[model samples]
Target: MRNAMWMQGVEWLAAAASDPQACKREWERGAGTVLLEAGRHWDVVSVPRQLGLLALDILWYDPLRTPGPTLVDSAAHRVGFFVPPDPAGNWAGADIRRASKGSWVAVPPPYRSAGSVEWIVPPDGSGTLHPPLTLELALRQANKTLAVLAPVSAD
Candidate 1:
C-alpha cells in the first residue's frame, strides 16, 4: 500500500520527465520538476542524508491509484526534494555511482511521522531514460514502491 504511493509518485515523475522541457531540465539539473500534488499540502520539509537531500512536502492528498501507482490529477500541491546534490555541481544522472540517502518527514500537527524514508538510486549505469530510475536502497524501498506502485509484484 505504502509502496504503491511512492511508485505512483515515480511514475508520475517519469511521465512528467517525458516532457522535453522537464527532461532537459532533469538532464541539466540534479533535481527535476515534478507535478506531485495532494488535495492539500500538509507541510513541506527536507529529507536529509550524507549523499544528498530531497524535499518532501506533505500534500493533503493520497496517490490516485494505489495498490498500483497513478498520480491524482486533483491532489493538493507542494514541492518535495528527491536528492541532496549541489545546486551548483553537475546534476546527478546516469553513470553516477554516488547514491543519495533520503530521510522521512511528517507534515502538520502529527506528533510523529506518517510516510517512510528512502535512498533514491538511479539505474546501475543507465540514465538515458531508456531505463527507469533504479533504486539500490533497501528491500524496504522496493517493497514500499511495489506495494504502492503495483508493478513490482507483476513479475
Candidate 2:
C-alpha cells in the first residue's frame, strides 16, 4: 500500500505534462527522463549543488517545515526544488535559477536514480509543495553556511 501511494504521487506529478498519457508511457518504456513545463501547477528553483544539499539538510531538520520534491543533476552540479508557482519568481541569489511559466524541466522517472539527474526527495503524492517563504529562508541559511565552511581564497 505504501509503494502504491508513492506511485500515485509520481503520477500526480506526471499529470503536469502537456500530454500526461504520453509522459507516463515514456516512463513505462524506460525513458530516463521527460520534459515538463513549469509554472502551471508548480515552479522549480535550482541552485548550486553544494548550497542545495545544505539547504535540503536544513529543511529536513526543521520541525515546522517539510520540503517538497527536490532533484539533483550531478553532471551540472545543480539541484532543483519544487515550489508553488509565480510567487517564487522574484527569488534572487548568487546562483539560483527559477524555472517559471515558459521554462521546461527534465524530470526523471520516480524509479530512476542512476542518471545525470535524480531525485533527492521525491513527491509524496500529497500535492504538498515547498512554501516559498520557508524555502527562501532555508536557502539563505544554506548560503551562509556554505560561505563559512569553504571560504574562497584570494590569489
Candidate 3:
C-alpha cells in the first residue's frame, strides 16, 4: 500500500523533473514540498560497547503495508548510529562516494554526522562531503541521495 503510493510519488517526481515549469512550481513551494509521507515504525536499541560508546541497532518498519517491502525490516547484526537533522530539517553531513562499480553513492544519515565517529562502513567508500544546502542544492542533493540510497537501502 505505502510502496504503491511512494512509487506514485516517485513517478510524479520523475515527471516534475522532466518539466521545467512544474519543477519551477515545486521549487517555489520550497521546504513545504513534501513529495510523500507514510507511517514509519522505528526501533532504536542501544547495546553497550567499548571506548565508552554504545552501539545502536536501528530498525524501521511500516505497519500500513500489506505484503510489500518495509524499510528497516530486520534487526541489525551490528550496531548503528543515530543521525540528527540540521536546522533546515536537512541532513548535515551528507557525502558522496564513488562505488567500485563506477557509480556515485550517498551514505545514509547518522553515519553522515559532522565528525569522524562512524562505527560501520559507509554505504559507498568514504563519501565526499556535501556542501551547505540552498533550495536548488537541496533538490539536487535529494535527487542524488534518493537515486543512490533508495536502490541499495530502500526496501
Poorest stretch of ten by lDDT in candidate 3: 51-60
> For each predicted model, how many residue pairs clash, with residues at least 3 apart or on different chains?
18, 1, 0
Model 1 lDDT at residue 133: 20
lDDT of candidates 1 onward, in order = 0.25, 0.85, 0.26
Displacement of residue 53 (Cα, Å) in model 2 is 0.3
**Which of 2 and 3 is ahead in TM-score?**
2
- Residues 18-48 of candidate 3: C-alpha lDDT, one tens digit per residue: 3535543543443222221111111111122
* Candidate number with greatest TM-score: 2
Candidate 2, residue 119: Cα displacement in angstroms equals 0.7
What are the RMSD figures for all models against the true structure? 18.1, 1.7, 18.5
Error of 1 at 44 (Å): 13
Residue lDDT tens for model 1, 44-69: 12212311121111111225411111
